[model samples]
Target: MAGWMNLVNEWLVPALVLSSLAAHLVVVVLAAVRRREASGWPRAILWLANQAADLAATQTLGNLFLGSTSREKHLVAFWVSFLLIHMGRPDNISAYSMEDSVLSARSVIEAIFQIAGAIYVLIKHIIIGGGGGGDGRTFVLASITMFLVGIVKYAERIGALWLGDLGSIQSSGKKLKRASLSVGHLEISDDEQALQAAHRLLHITKGAFADYSSDEVEHKSSHANDEQARLAAARRLLHIARGTFADGNDNGSRWSWSQGWEQLFRLVEMELSLMYDVLYTKAAVIHTWHGYCIRFASLHFTAIAFWLFSLSSKDGYRWSDVYITYLLLIVTFLLEVRWLLSALASTWTYAFLINTNSGLRHAALCSGRWRRLRRFVMSLDLCRLALVRDPSSYRMWSGKIGQYNLLSECTHDMTSFYRTLAQRFGSEDSWKEYKYCYSGVLHISSPVRNILFNNIWDKLKLAYKPEEMRAMAAMPVPHDNDARRRNKLDKALRFAPELQDYILTYHLATDIFLQCSGQKGAACAFVKTIEVLSNYMLFLSVVRPYMLPGLKIHSLYTATRDALHDIW
Candidate 1:
């Protein structure tokens, strides 16, 4: 019976912990994979797998000291290192959503509990069987070093959690003060063509939005180019329509983009990078000087401690424990390597290398080759088929942009799905299968944004009021508001000098355009495209108010939402 119990302690328990540890290590590798251009389901599966492995490893470590008499000192030290390694999550991913940051308090509490558990396990091991695998003093000191490293890494995550919240950004006294200083000024960048253009336009629109002399804003821009101005204004409207309110503050909001919408594909490329930063990367601090410091410290400490453990004698320990320790050491260093590679592969790294004369930039020497490499590394096909989705998929993750459908908006929400309407309402005699569903792909070389931006810019130029033009321009302006009528109320509202009215009015006009055009020619298809995109923008404004520039739309959106809900 004593022999049997020893066998259980020597093999069974270690095997369980090994399984958990192996699962955790595999997740650390698998999580490195990015399927941004791939379908959404694969990413979701990978994320779930990583989370499960994390929980399992934590539980198994706790079980190490639970009522059992198998107190191995080396096992305790390995446990400390595992805890630290897990805390150093993939560089690209922090909280999966804004809500994750909100609930991060729970994670903080759990970390505290785990820390306490580690303390208990260490104490219990000392009382039971003594030092891990070497001289008592040496093992204790080694364990302490790894523990401190883990604690520091864990603390960084807690800080990230506290700061990553949308509410937190608004609440941070430090960040808010910095943001307040820039509200009235344009954030210019010569490196980012669209952002530079937007900066100039922001100067003019900032005045229209609030209190500023348009003359002073224009005077400051006497040296700026007009092409940047046009492209910026167009891209800004697109960002507004898409629910990406990139800037915020006391003075006003500014939108920035690296590529102009005129080239089209470049905007798509840059959009992918920006979305990744906001959604996954810790854009808040990971690229900062302090971020680099913490990463270097964590890496060096982990590698050093792992080397010490690798060199220590392993005689007195069970064979299973010895094997597991070797495995842990190998995994720790491998993860560090993977982490470094991920940091290099980030968009922030690319920007940093471009802006500086860092000797590390030889990898990206040729611009054309660099772009091709970027597309291959950065793009992923995010396909969540609208026609074949379950309700659960919608609840799993909330994107920066909510889903939209023009046909559904014509009716009540949740009462029906849009594809059903397309099928049921169609003229069956014309063709057999008429199916329309919207599944967005993130990495297509589509020029749809460029088309939309130019069209909107032209409309704004045509609709500019006399005083508005005189106020915004450095010289006399052209008068071009003589276009034919299309419901004066809608026309006036659509072309109103205010940006908000443009968002609302265009939504209404598209519906009217669709009703009048009928579903036939090339004209109909073009009108239909405008209608869907335009109405979707309005739907986004209503459903996702936070993503819009700070504005008052409760009553208007409520009425629109109520009407849509009824039809839905």
Candidate 2:
């Protein structure tokens, strides 16, 4: 057992060191790929890598601190710096979710320890080992160069995380001022224009999600006569519409909407994409002058370090370790190059270039060279070209909502499964309730989209005043829906005070109504829409309770499930 332990320790450092690099590669490749994918597997892998990448590197650094006499000291010291660099994930993914960002304090402490550990490893292996000759000096120089770059990269990560944290943002207490969103007849004919437009409105969406209220007094009129003009109007309308999500009084009174549901959906989807970047990615930190400067500095230092390492002596190091070191250097350079290219082609960068009164604006926008460069970058969209049959295009969120049918689940019987597992955990009622709450997802159809759009539009038309609009928000359904229906709805609302209870009550009622009124032709479409929405609301209550107000009582859902089952 002692011999086995020794053997395990002997190979663990090299294995973990290489695993760190492999995890970095996995994270970068998977982060891009996962955006286009809706499956659980790609996201699962990406989340695992996002978590394990830092752990593997940190563990490897800790093992190096134990001191190895077999490996060359200079090579080990160089590897330590690379580990520090690896701690800063690629800009494509800074945090997997907002919860990760909320732990900013813990991250700061962890980063401090990791950085200190790397510095200690450098001191132990290089400065303490003594610079013996020309090769020794070169190695020390390379290590120091990488050490500076590593620190910069780590600082960027922590800053990005801090900027994303809700507590940090709320504590700042800065009021949001509306930007002058005057595009002045700028039509979105191409992807470049659309991207720039999205970038321009990115802040509005970010503020809306963060519960920041914006003050805009000017009311802009949109005379959208054609398709391009309508799209342009829709873009500006997004700025006003964002207030509704933030619970602000502004319900798009500032701008008139002339576009259809399709254009509105597209605009909302783009804003959601931007929101993802702001919250999860490094868009909060990058897309600034300093971000650009530090990125280029990191790139240059990496190139110089690679050159210095290559020029230094490799006589004492193992051939495999030397090759692995070279591999890390080359991969790091290539990843930085990829990030640079992507940033250049990004809409955020485009908005910065055109909006700013700098020479770069001319070089990037007016010059033919930058246009061609951006065009080239667009052609190399890694996520789009990854899978030929990938269905999602130019959309961020999967345009699908989950569906959990209480009535449907209650009807299905699993006798074999019931015999084996029904009473294993709890009572039969509990098992049945648990099974009933499992959800399935379905894409929103054109009819359902139209129904939703028309309903909201009708409500908006009715509410001319801001107070009226606010009052209407509490009434999800039309008050004038036949007298009997209204009476039934009011009665149901009396018993269901919590939002979750109300949703379940309405969902069950809607399911029963649909079952009874199985009308054909046009009425069938209405029935289907009702069914979809009812199931969707139930799905949200079960699966994503945080999105809705009020706490979700599992017992309520369980009791409802059992009652519905008994009735059937």
Candidate 3:
């Protein structure tokens, strides 16, 4: 019975060990192929090292179970040195090298250690006989120690792989977002141009969506329509603005663009909201996968460890039992390492999601503020029209004016709200805080500011009353030199052939407001407000002439010329 048992141990066990090692190598190779693009060199190195250890473990186990031949023992010792060389090292930062000199040096050192260990194992086995009993306690203790060391090494490798995956996902997401934003810049400036640009962007965005969706088929398809609708709405607004301007009814035409602009802005906000949702969903999926990997690895290691421990107890303290226990421990270590890596990957995914969500929120708030400002301008247009149609309709006109004033106040409140939110939720030093928190982007661009001022100027230029026109003209130019202010007045006159009389009226009205308020700055603010109105009128005048049938390049040029000449 003992002879039969020895034969089973010597032949059967070695063959099984060799087969397991081969399986591990195949699996590692497959995984490497699948993850090559995203996997860093460090991860690859660790994986290769693990495979080497498995190879060593197989050889060592075979030698112990078979008749502990000196050559076989020496081979096992060499593998130990190989494993030690990798295990003793700290992580390498750079993955790619023509030759890993450190690893090479360690390999040589391991060879020497392996020769020594092999000789020791061979001599002991020959003297005591292959089946000689040893202290079971020492063998069991050594097996356990080896098992733990293997586990630690495997855990480190797995952790590195998980973190690398997280980094790759984050980079892809950021690249997509940047592409979207680049497309967004097309929405700025003139209606027709902006519409065409937005349409092109929408097409590009859809293509990207299709590519990404192919990889993540589980994602809902609802967002596609939302993005399409947004682009369409923005284009519609541009068409309306062009139509209204061409009709020559400034107030009514402006109203068309205002409503369309509001719709388009809302759509943009919705698009941003959808982006946050998609990112969050992707993050959840990544986390789920990571958890699954951890659980699977843990179960695998636990089963192997339990099986080995059970057999070792039955066999008593023999070299073969010690070798089997060592193999089981190494397996357990590998699983534990995989779990650690999965956890780290999940953490990085969470960070990326949070960062993107915050950016989208900031964009939404900024769009909301712009929408409110549009409504305020529309209200003012209605009030002016009511007053002009019926001089005795003071009550009706006053109500409209009051509504307009309220809307203006609402816009200010919205600005304050955004400022508070930025301070609370965003990093103080981030670009979002700098651009949107205090309207820094709006402040820095003199050309855009001039455009806004021009729009406001257009409204003031249409004042029916001489006194009102005088009050507007008297409004100060905040940063304009005397020459610049005069130039603007000249430009306004060029757009509105009737503005020369209007300017005299505005100057008189300005004196009246100045006397009523002791504060000169208050008087200046009111004057600057009128200048803003003139700028708006200039914009309308330029846009209006181009709205006619048989639109020509000359017509466009004339409109711009009139506005620029008037402002200059």
Candidate 4:
């Protein structure tokens, strides 16, 4: 019976623990690479991570409490270290779904149960004699240190889920707003009262429970240091209609450069970034000095435990058990170092880089590989979108930006035929890499964004209150010589008042100009680019109406959508 029990302990228990840890490590790698895409793979990986962590925890406790093998103390230390490193998951993602965030209370309860189990294992095995002989002193010390760190790490995740709930965010917004910052006046036509009302919204929306100091971003928002800020600014401009291509509100939109749409966009993006950090990153808990102090204490404790284990005798322990203990020690240190690097790469660190003394900032930016590191920190995009070139182009923006006819549907079949033909003839490398689209969205280069924004701004100037127009005229256009020309937006903008007219005309024009002429046309790629953008911009209008107060709602999205079947 004693020999049989040792066989089970060495083989079955070890297998269970190794399987759990191996599954967790694989899931961690997949989640890091694919979390951004809205796909089934990410969901599957998150599920595996959660399940593996639980399995590992249960196995660790089992080995600690019931083991009689001579290698018991070493296995206990190894399992505890496994739990700690597993707890230190990637910061950018916590829960896989909104429902997961809502279940945060349950998560906390489960964490409490796990903690209790771990404590029970410790008292029964180390303090008593369940671990069976040998100096268990050093093993208990190390297990305690890892348990504390793991507990705190798990607690942070549950707390982040609670914070991440959109309902909680909305509730906080309602309580906040002790004082509203003055948004400057928008002097526009009385015909465009919607535009005027939109301007009345305050930039910094504070939650009543805790004050969010959004004004801290004032200087940061002023500069276009990252792509998000630039995109947000483009959305703030009021020259486009919300839906459809028809002009409605752009005539009266006017705000000064310093305090107008630009500043508002900057503030909006920053607040969202803050909320994302609270939900996904360690900003809410670990960025604090207290968090850092505890982190270092845990590290010191782990190091001390390592030293103690080295000094202690290991006469009866199996060689494999000795190797496992050292493996856990080395892996724990590696994880801690990795966590340190992740914390340093955060946006919180970027703020310090920007404001610190000139020499440090310069060194960070101009030094060898440090510049690449700084760029990585600065360009962290929370929301990334890519255009699926083929499927993405299939839809129209509010049924206005492009038109669909029975004939045009056939044209798409032709497009498909050509694409297939091209694929067959193309090199294997090119075919393999090509998507119906590429790895990106409607927005292109900076120059394109500038032209798109300025074109709408200029058109809206026609309706601005006379005084507002005069003020804008006095200030310099944010872009340079070529952008000032109206021709810059000619191709990009659908100048037609009726979105139907624009789409139908473009379809008819392209078919007649390209297919009739027996060619894809000199401007085929350009035309396709404009068409894709029009559809995407229209989609953005309906789904994210609040983001684009200027042109987000110009077209009658439902109305146009309703008419689509009839047109087809």
Candidate 5:
């Protein structure tokens, strides 16, 4: 038993260090997968890797503190610095979801503890040790430099989380003032144009919807042609319209519609893609001034430490430990370089360059050479093309909506037991997962998309004012005095005051109609359209209550489910 314990202890720290490195590699490699519509396995793997990164690093640090088996204290101390760097996480990711940003306080506490542990490890293993080879001062300085770099990175992550928090977002909605320069004369590809436009219009989603105005907030450039500005404005308006709806803060909003349906659809997709970046990724941190500072500092300190370590004596350390140290240093340097390059080539940086004047730096960045270089870097598609063979197959969104039917759920019950268990003992997320497990998705066909767009477009054309847009949510049934005398729909409408009630009622009615129609009109595409729209409405009410207005829709769904089960 003692021999087994010894063996485990001997191999554990190195194994954990390597595991942590592997996890970091996974994170960096999969960094381009920012869309929620990406495969669930990649997301799941990324999530696990994110969790394992800190776990492996923290555990290894603990092991080192508890007296590691290695005799090379200096090498072990150097490994401690690398562990700290690992804990800071990669630049491309910070939160896996919105919930993570909200729980930034927890992350802060965890970072404090880890930083304390790292400092303790450094103090014990390097600062107090006296047996290393010639001129240990430079080695100690190198370790200290790497430690400072780790702290800066960790701070950057914490700041990112705080910046992305919902409360912070709500409070600082007016802080992001419009830039002075609009992007112009850039001979770029379609994807690059979309990225540039998204970055330009990001402020609409990032801040209060009430603050947006085309003339007041839009960045205008004297060099930009009038036709170009008009086209960009049209695209921006479409993006803002969807952004306002997705944000859900504004009760009523009006946006000018000039773009075609295709452009409008693509604009919505790009807007959502941008929202994902702001809410879930490190875009909030890496696009700002301080973000640039931290990236430069990280690269600078890493290079300095590498040089210092190489110049310092390593006679006393084991060859294996020395090789591992070199590996860690080289990897850190390369990652920092990659992150810096990514930031420089980003659309945000392009926007920044167009906006700012930094003397020689401004001239260099604005030059045609810099534009060509940026174009070249973007053409590599390092994040997307490397991971996915066919770029066309990859999209920011899957362009499918969840399909659910209240009657179908009531009739074919499968997850009732699991859902009950979840409600009784599990978290809110568990309950949601089980309750909605049976829901499927359907691609919105092109004809259906056109019909939906035309209906909304017709309504918007009539709704000149914001209040009229808000009123458009109501069922605009043309009041036929004769039909009103014949039917009791007024009473039915009163009974279904809540959106949930209306959704369920429509869903049941549609299901009944479809069942009765059978093969009679099944050949018609409109039949499928009716079924699809009904299921989608039910899906919104059941699986994604927050997307709808008002509160307690989940409770309403639960009550409906119970009543249906009892009737059954």
Candidate 6:
């Protein structure tokens, strides 16, 4: 046993130390070669220095174990090796040129302790004379110091891991909160407003659907049967109109704000899922990179463990050496576990991307189905309108002519005012003046008109005053001497309220649909339709005197004067 121990101590330990040094040198050389094309030379110098230190340490360890008469040489080599280890430490190495005072202080303290320990080991080695002659107490103290250093290094690694986890959790929570707020604030109320908006939306939707449907039908008809294409087109339009009306219901209605929020949240979630899928794909790539790092680290750790084991086993392994081997094994185990987790994460991320892509495709299909249904409803409505001979035949048609007459008178008054203004002013200047006048009249009269005739009566309740705020309101509103002509206008401006409302609703609905179709030409057509409708209403008003009852010419004249004044 003593002979075997002597052979291990004198030969095996020194050989193993040399092998470890050679391996380290090879690694440093490879690192240098790989980084040769790097922008800077400092990294290459550092790696070269590390390799030199490793070689020195290997030589010193081998010579010390072999009882070489070169204490100064061993000490110098040991110091160099220690310095290299300290430099490799994450906290000890700074990316910038500026030294970190706290890290420097810690390093100095560590170096002091290491130097003291090295001195004690040297003294014990000198007394041993090639035999393990140190007192157990000295060995224990040395082991304790080494253990403490390992603990510090491990604690630092753990802290970094915890901090990363905390940051990820915080970021995830903030994203969720933002998504929640976006959904919470997207509610709409006021049925009248909703109905008006819906009508407008419907008009736009119908117009867009019609144009697209016509084109699609023409294309289909040219290739196939025209009758079938026409039928399909009609069905598509009707479906679109119905869907638009259904979708336009305000949140306050049966659909509710909660439902809208739920839908929007679902959309956001779906979008997030897609984003996550992309991130997952990226993470997979990152994981692959990390895997390579893990494999490299594992190889180094394995080499270190084997080398340490070889030395300790040869030199009559002490408790300290055994503990270090265990620690190295622990490090290797951790690296293996981390590598496994990274690989799993990469696999999971790839699966997630695939699933998300499928889900997105499904969502697109659902959207297309919904749009098709909406188009079908619109086509049905259009067909019904086409079949009707008189506007009065429709359910929304009002037989009363008083409203029409009233509107007609109002139109005529506006035209006459425009004509007079144009004659008095140059055509170019008059046109500008007319636009401003119309814009102002529309802006002011819109609220009043909406309140008096539409469902905005409740909103105007606070605006009503006992002649106190009336002055203020009156100040904002332009006055006209034609107020006395109200009786004459009431009789002249008669029209069917239901019919007018229906026409306006249809027009608005068509416009809304057109906007949704994402067609620029359809949008232009909708705008043109609105302008034409406004002009037609004005023309009808101009001819009010020849139309129905309840429209007073005098009252309409007063309203026109006020409208023009408000416009200006």
How good is model 6 by TM-score?
Answer: 0.19
Off by over 4 Å in 1: 1-39, 69-73, 103-106, 126-128, 132-141, 172-260, 263-279, 316-318, 341-449, 459-568
Please report the candidate that would top TM-score against the real structure: 2
List TM-scores for all candidates, in order. 0.56, 0.79, 0.21, 0.55, 0.75, 0.19
When summed lDDT is taken over every stretch of 10 residues in candidate 4, the lowest stretch is 391-400
Give the TM-score (vs. native) of candidate 4. 0.55
Against the true structure, candidate 2 reaches a TM-score of 0.79
lDDT (0 to 1) per candidate: 0.47, 0.64, 0.36, 0.47, 0.63, 0.33
Where does model 6 exceed 4 Å of error?
A: 1-285, 289-318, 346-348, 351-568
How many clashes would you count in candidate 4?
17
Candidate 4 per-residue lDDT over residues 1-568, each given as its tens digit: 9999978856765566566666556655565333233224455566676577667767766666565533456556446546644654445556544456665467667767776666666565555543434556665565666666666666666666766554555444545443543333343322123222332332232221122222221121121222232234333332221111122323344345323333333333334344445545455565555555655665666677678677656666676767767766666665565455556554454444544566866776456444466345334422221332221111111122212232333334433664577568874323222321122223344444445545555544444434543443455642221123222233234433354434444544555565566664244555554444554444334333333323332355445544554554
Rank by TM-score, highest first: 2, 5, 1, 4, 3, 6
lDDT (0-100) at residue 1 of candidate 6? 100
Count backbone clashes in candidate 2.
Answer: 0
Estimate, for each residue in 1-568, the C-alpha lDDT of model 5 and write its tens digit.
Answer: 9999987975677678778888888988776554543234566678888888788887877776887434466677678777776666787777766567765467678888888888887877777773355668888788889989987787777777787665666456535544532322221134445555556555554432222342232322222222232233344444344434321224432234554344445555565566555656677889778888888998999999999989988787778777888888899999998888778876667766655666645665746656776666656776666655543225345556777777767776646676667667876554543344323446788777777777655543432233433343242542232123212322322323376677777787778877886832375667767877888877767766544543446777778877887787
Compute the lDDT for candidate 6.
Answer: 0.33
* Comparison by lDDT, 2 against 3, better one: 2
lDDT of 1 by residue, 1-568 (tens): 9999988855654555565566555554444344231224445555675565456557556666574544354564456556545644555566544445554567778878876776676666643345454565455555566776666666666666665543443333222222232433433332254333233233223321122222221212211122232233333333222222232322454443333333332333333334334434465566556766666776777677676666665557767677776676667666665555445444455555554575556657444545555444333312323422421121111222223444455564333455455457754211111112114322211244446655654553343433443343333321111111112222533533344445776666666555676742234445545654664566445543333343646677557657766655
Give RMSD to native, each candidate.
11.9, 8.6, 25.5, 12.8, 9.5, 31.8
lDDT of 2 at 393: 43
Clashes by residue pair, model 5: none
- Clash count, candidate 1: 16
Tell me which of candidates 5 and 6 scores higher on TM-score. 5
Clashes of 5: 0
Worst 10 residues of 1 by lDDT: 478-487
Global lDDT for candidate 1? Answer: 0.47
